[model samples]
Target: MRSSTIRRALAAASTVSMLALSVSACSEDTANDSTVDFGYIGDYNGVSLLAIAKKLGLWKEVGLTAKVKAFNDGPIQVQALRAGNLDFGYIGPGAMWLPASGKAKVVAVNTLAYADRVIAQPGITSMKDLKGKKVGVPEGTSGDMALNLALEKAGMTAKDVQKVPMAPATIVSAFSSGRIDGAGIWYPLIDTIKAKVPDLEEVASTRETDSSFPTAFVAGNKVKPELTSKVIKVLQKANDWRARHPREAITESARMLELDESKVKADAANVETLPTADLVAKTKDGTVDKWLNVLGDFFVRNGQLESAPDPSSYYTGDLYTKAYAK
Candidate 1:
């Protein structure tokens, strides 16, 4: 066989073997019933709410044996969900646009407000100052996309600056060595980097942006849509817990994420946790549709997508409505 053909055959064989192994490990009961495997981009503050959900057994209470896994970033997490390795995960608006166009359906908007920021060395005041300066970003992540958006808002692009693609964990070392002028990342790392550099300045925050960026709970398109209701229920329970017991939620999340309580509290405050009912109403009323269309258009105008897909099909408010109605 041709080399390309041989490689394709090997990949197919590997996939089959993995599927067979997964099937073999399933009990008769579990073989028929569905299980949801949730994925998220790693970083204590980014997934602090998820940590609280898991710690409080919210998923179990909602009839899901939720297997939450950590990924490097949103792009990777979405890819895993697309491949059937994960049932659901959180994804930023940018990453969600691409997959939602394909076969991934967003079930609920996790957060609407921007909860991220672009932090740079003290002396770097603006995107213009970042020109010719090395910047570290978790490539293909929401953070990287956010950085691109910041640059665009400042009338620049990635080509206007030196780009260094690194994982979030390694950004601190890169910053300390003076190898990077800035790092676009989320909290906890933002907190850590600030402590290490003391004089680091935030150039932009999601809070200041004009867009309502939607980070969502997504599931594979092929999965039974009914399971989405279970996922929404779990999320609703978690959100309700947050409102009723903010301190306990913060404490449990901090312990689970191994971060200081104050940082966790700060991160929690930044998140706009929505109940499934509100999300369903908002989505049905075209709130999320409007945002997704705007974001899609932004990507297309900037040449991100070949053509924009219909935002309506990208999300279904049905699951949220059903889950929250109960």
Candidate 2:
């Protein structure tokens, strides 16, 4: 009787062990099929892959759902990221300082040669003409950096101009009503500004001075690598779709952002988003590292940082490789 009782207890223990293992497997699978929150600027001015991914339902197709948030600028996005309110954000090179200052990590490259322009009134045809004028700029942005470079090249400084702090969207109305003499902004808003001011002149732009600017997908240090890798995979798919269907991409972006399709097209013309292969290659080949270093050096010179941080400390191409290999 005693031997039979002992056998029954052992059998029951084995059964419970098997049941727990099955439940653990199911939970692991469920974790793999979860939602991710993403953030980006609320305009068509930069690499808007998050919008494309949201429009195409690519995140769902990849076994993940995206909760997308649109921010007015990079600084707001940076705050959300640091507070753990976001799982990922697509930030422009202007805000690359986030990573350099140890606030975030760049996991993948979004676009190359992402440039901004300085638009002035008809008579303000040169950078020197910006002196003593009320110039609207989204400070601490790529446009602001571009304006600085142009000013430096022209032997001028931000002090030379009366800096009017404003966003690109606001720049439109202020500039149109003559509240501001000039604006340092990105496209398709550049075209929109021109429409409002018919004689707006392109005084300077990154197309000539700062061509190495590249936007990136950044995440907080605590975010899981697997999540970023999955996001990059979705981005790769969205980028390919955009490259293959340029007109549709523009229309969809405009519709999503609630902007005019014509303006979106004009903005698209000024930007070059890298194809998947090239993007993957660049990340793997240390090109992204070089670009981030250039961005860091710019901030240092602008008095934002004492020195540039080593790229490896804040950037990693491993995620790109892992996602692509999958």
* Best candidate, TM-score: 2
Best by lDDT: 2
Model 1, range 1-326, lDDT digits (tens) per residue?
A: 00000001111101111111011122334543356677654333335457667766665565556555655456666677778788877666557655646758877777654556777888888878888888898765556766878888898988888888886667766776677898777664566566678888788776777777777767787778667876777677776776677788778765654556776676556666665567677877888788788777777755667787887677777667677778
What are the models' TM-scores?
Answer: 0.83, 0.84
| Alpha carbon lDDT at 290, candidate 2 | 82
In model 2, state the lDDT of residue 68.
Answer: 61
Worst 10 residues of 1 by lDDT: 1-10
Worst 10 residues of 2 by lDDT: 1-10
TM-score of 1: 0.83
**What's the true lDDT of residue 145 in model 1?**
65
At residue 179, what lDDT does model 2 achieve?
90
Cα RMSD to the true fold for all candidates: 8.5, 15.7
